[model samples]
Target: MKHIRNFCIIAHIDHGKSTLADRLLEHTKTIGERDMMNQVLDDMDLEREKGITIKSHAIQINYPYKGEEYTLNLIDTPGHVDFSYEVSRALAACEGALLLVDASQGIQAQTISNLYLALDNDLEIIPVINKIDMDGAMIPEVTDQIIDLIGCKQEDILLASGKSGIGIEAILAAIVERIPAPKGDENGQLQALIFDSVFNSFRGIIIYYRILNGSIKKGDKIQFASTGQEYFADEIGVLKLTMTPKPEVKCGDVGYLITGIKVAKEVKVGDTITLANNPAPMIKGFEEVKPMVFAGIFPVNTDDFAELRDCMEKLQLNDASLTFELETSQALGFGFRCGFLGLLHMEIIQERLEREFNQTVITTVPNVSFIAYTSKGDKIIVNNPAEMPDPTKLDRIEEPFIKAQIITLPDYIGNIMTLCLGKRGILINQSYLTTTRVELTFEMPLTEIVFDFYDKLKSQTRGYASFDYSPIGYREADIIKMDILLNGDKVDALSALIHRSRAQDFGRKLCEKLKELVPRQQFQIVIQAAIGAKILARENISAMRKDVTAKCYGGDISRKRKLLEKQKEGKKRMRQIGNVEVPQEAFLAVLKLD
Candidate 1:
C-alpha cells in the first residue's frame, strides 16, 4: 500500500491529455510499442469522431524506480463542461492530478474551471506544459502564467511534447516522487468508493471503485450505503488495458467488482460499498449533477417507443446526469422529456439511439426551465414550450440566468461586447489577464445563449475566444410565448418563448424562414406568427397558378373576366377547406435562423 500512487490527468479539451496518457503507458511498458495507439483510453466512437473525451477511463501501471517498484493508477478525465461531474468523481478517487496545459494556447476557459475543481478537492497538482515541439510554442510565457496562477516555481513546471515522447521519463519519475501514496486502514471494516460503473451483457454491473478502508475478495457479500442493497461479489480484478481477474483487492488499490446484478440501475456511481456482515461508515459522496438543458425526444415511428425507452434505460445506467420522463404531445405523439447537461450531451444521446438501437428519433427545440406564478397563487416550473400556461393565466414569469466568462484577445473586445449586448446580456465586470488578452464577464439569460451563442462567438473571434458559463438564480423577465400558425391553425411544435421587445423581428424572421422550407401546395399557404390573438408577422406563398386564359383562344374580355372571377372563388373555398401538412423540416427550420 505504501508504494501505490493514485493520480489523474486534468486539462482543457485538445490539450494533449490523452496523448500524455499514451506516452506514460509506453514509458512504464504497461502497453507494448506495437500495441500503442493514439488516445487508446478514448473508447467511444463519437468521442474519437468529435476529437473530445466523453468518458473517464482508469488504468493501472507498474513502474520500477531505483530497484523500488511503484504501482501507479491513472484516471483519464473528460475536459468538456458537460462532463464536469465525471471529472469530480475521478478527482475524488485520486490523491493528485497532472494539470496539462498547451504551451502555445496557455490557459483556456476549461483549464481554469478544471484547475479550480482540483483545488477544491485538495489534491496535489503537478503542472506540466505539453506540445513543446510545436513551432508556435511559447514555453517561457506559459511557464510564467503557471507560476502566477498556481504559485509554483518555474523549474517545477515540466516541459514535454506528448507527440514526440519528450520528457516522458521525467513525468513518470515526478509522479512516483511527488504524488503521495494512498493511505487507508487495511484491517478496518470493508469500505470502498464507486467512482464509475458499466453494464456488461454477460457479467451484469461491473463497478469501478477505490478501496479506502479494507479489502474485498471473491465471494464477499457487499452492501451499498446509499440504497442499502446487498449483493455477493462474484469476481474482483484490476484493469490492465482490460479487466484481469484477481482473488482479492486490498485497501488503497483501485479495481472493479462484479456484483452479479443484472439490472444497470441496481448500481450507481458515487455510492459507498461495504461488507454486508460488518459494514463500516460510508464515505462522503459528491453532489448530484443537475441538467442545464431540456428537450423532448420522440421516436419517428410510434411503434419504436418501447425500444427507445429500453435504449434510454441502458444509457442512463452509464450516465447518471441524463434524466427523462414520459411525455405526450398532440403534434409529436408519445415520447420522453429528456434533460441533458448541454447541447453536446443531447446530440450524443440522440446519435447513440439511432446508431446503436436503430431507432430514428425526433427532438424538439431545447429549452431552459422557467418558474411561472399563476393567478390562483400556484407556482409551476415548465421546461417545454407547450407546457406553458396561457398568457392571461400567468402572474409573472422568471427565466434561468447564467454567469458567462469569456477569454479572448483584446482586439476582439468590441465585437464580443456587441454580440453580448445584442443577446440582452448585462455586463457585470471586465478584467485584463495580460496586455494582449482580456476577460469579460456577463450575466445573461440562459435561453439567449443555449443555441447559437457559442457558434457566433467562434465566428466573431475567428476561433480565438474560449467561453464557459454556470447557472445563477432565476430573474424576472418580460417573456412571452409566441406561436406559429399554418393555414390559420396553431402548431404546437413551433411555439417559442421570446421577449416582447424582439417579438416582431423574431416572428418575421421565423415566418420568412418557414416559408422557404415549407413545400408548395395546390392552394396558397399562409404562414403567420402570433402572440395570443394578435398576429405579428405573415407571409403568403401563392398557389401554383394554372393559366385559365390559356384555354380561351379568342374569347371576349368580359368572358375572360368572368372565368377569372370564378377561378378566384374556387381557390378561396379550397384554401378554407384544405388541410396543410407541415413537414418535420419546417418545425426545425426556426432553430437555424440568425
Candidate 2:
C-alpha cells in the first residue's frame, strides 16, 4: 500500500495534458519507444482529429525513484466542459491530481473549473506549469496566477516543457513523494467502485474498477450494488497498455474485472461491486448525470431504425451519460429523442454513429427543456418544440437559464459585453484577474447560447476568450414559438422558441434565408413566418417560367394575346395545386443564421 500511487491529470483543452501523459509513459517505459504514438490515451480517432479528449482512460505504470519501486495508476481525463461529469468520476477514484496549466496561455476557464472539482473531491493537487519551451511562455506570471488561485507556495509549483521532456523525472519523484498511498483494510469485505466499462463480443462486459477493501480473484462471485445482479468473476487483470491477467487483485489496487454476464446494461459506471456471499457496505457514489441538451435524431432511411437502436445500445455501454427514447415525427418519420450533456456531446455521438456504426442520421437543432403552464393550471415539461402546447391554451412559459463565465483579455471586454447583452444576458458581475485580463459573469437563457454563441464569441475575441457555464434553473420570460410555413404548410422541424422582442427580426431573417436555400419549382413558393395567426414576415420565390410565345412564329397579334392569357391561367392553377418540397438544406438554414 505504501508503494502504490493513484492520480489523474486534469487541465483545459489543448493545455498539454495529453502531451504530458505521453512523456510520463515514456519516462516510465510503460510503452516501448517503438509502440508509442502521439496522444496514446486518446484512443478515438475523432479525439485525435479534433485535438480534444472525449473519454477518460486509465493505465498503470511502474517507476523507480531513489531505488524504490512505485506503482502509479494514472487516469487521463477529458478537459472539455461537456465531459465534466466524466472528469468528476475520474477524480473520485483517485487520491491525487496533477493540475497542468499552459505557461503561454496561463490559466483558462476550464483550468479553474477542474481545479475546483479536484478540491471538492479532497484530493492533493500538484500544480505544474507546462509548455515552457514555447517562445511566448510566461512562467513567472503563470506561477503567480497559480499561487493566487490555490494559495500554494511558489517553490512547490513545478515548471517543465512536455514537448522537450524537461523535468520529467522530477514530476515522477513528486508523484511518489507528494501523493499519499492508497489506504484500505486488506482483510475487510470486498468492495470496489466501477469507474468505467466496455462491452466485448466474446467476454461480455469488461469493468474497470479500483478495489477499496478486500481482494477479488478469478473464481469469486461478485454482485453490483446498484443493480443487485450476481456473476462469477471470470477474469481479473491490470491495464498496462493491455489487459494482463492476474490471479488476484488485492485492496488498494486498480484493475479490470470480467463477469460472465452478457448483458451490456447490467454493468454501470459509478456502481459498487462486492463479494456476493459476504458483501460489504456500498461506497459513496457520485451524483447521477442529467443531460442539459435534447435533440431528435432520425435515421435517413426508416428501415434502419433497428440498426440505429442497436448501435445506440452498444455505444451506451461505453458512455453511460448518453440517453434516448423512441419518438415519431410527422416530418422526420420514426426516430429517437436523445438527451446530451451539451452541443459537443451531441456532435460526438452523431459523429460516432456515422463513422463507427456506418449509419446515416439526421439530427434536429438542440433545445433545452421548457416548462409550460396552461390556463387550466396544468404544468407540462417539453423537450421538443413540436410538443409545445397551443399559444392560446398556455398561460405562461419558462425556459432554462444558465450562469455563464467568460474569461478574456481586457481589450476585448467591451465586445464580449455587447455580444452577451445582445443575447438577452443579464450582467451579474465583472472582475479583473490582472491588469490586462478580466472575467465576466452573466445570467442568460440556455437556448440563446446553444446555437452560435460560442462561434460568435470566438470570432469577436479572435479566439482568445474561454467560457464555462452551469444551469441556474428556470426563469419566466416573454417567449413565443416561431413556425416556418412553406406554401401555407407548417414545417414542424423548422419551428423554434425565440424571445418575443427579437422575434420579428429573427423571423424575417429566417424567411429570407430559406428563400435563398429552397430550390425553385414549377410553381411560385411563398415562405412565411408566423407567431400564431399573424404573419411577421414573408418572401416569395418566383416560379420558373417558360416562354409561351416561343412556339409562335409570325402569328396574328390576336392569337399571340390568346396564347399568353391561356398560359397565365395555367400558371395560376399550378400555383394553387402545387405543394412546396422543402429540401433538408432549408431546415438547416435557420441554424446558420446569426
TM-scores of the models, in the order given? 0.95, 0.95
Clashes of each: 0, 0
lDDT of each: 0.88, 0.89
lDDT of 2 at 406: 93
Candidate 2 ranges beyond 4 A from true positions? 260-262, 553-579
Return the lDDT, model 1, position 531: 94
lDDT of 2 by residue, 373-441 (tens): 999999999888787898889999999999999999998998999999999999999999977679999
Ten contiguous residues minimizing lDDT sum, candidate 1: 582-591
Report per-prediction Cα RMSD to one decimal: 2.1, 2.0
| Candidate 2 local distance difference test against the native | 0.89
* Candidate 2, backbone clash total: 0
Q: What TM value does model 1 have?
A: 0.95
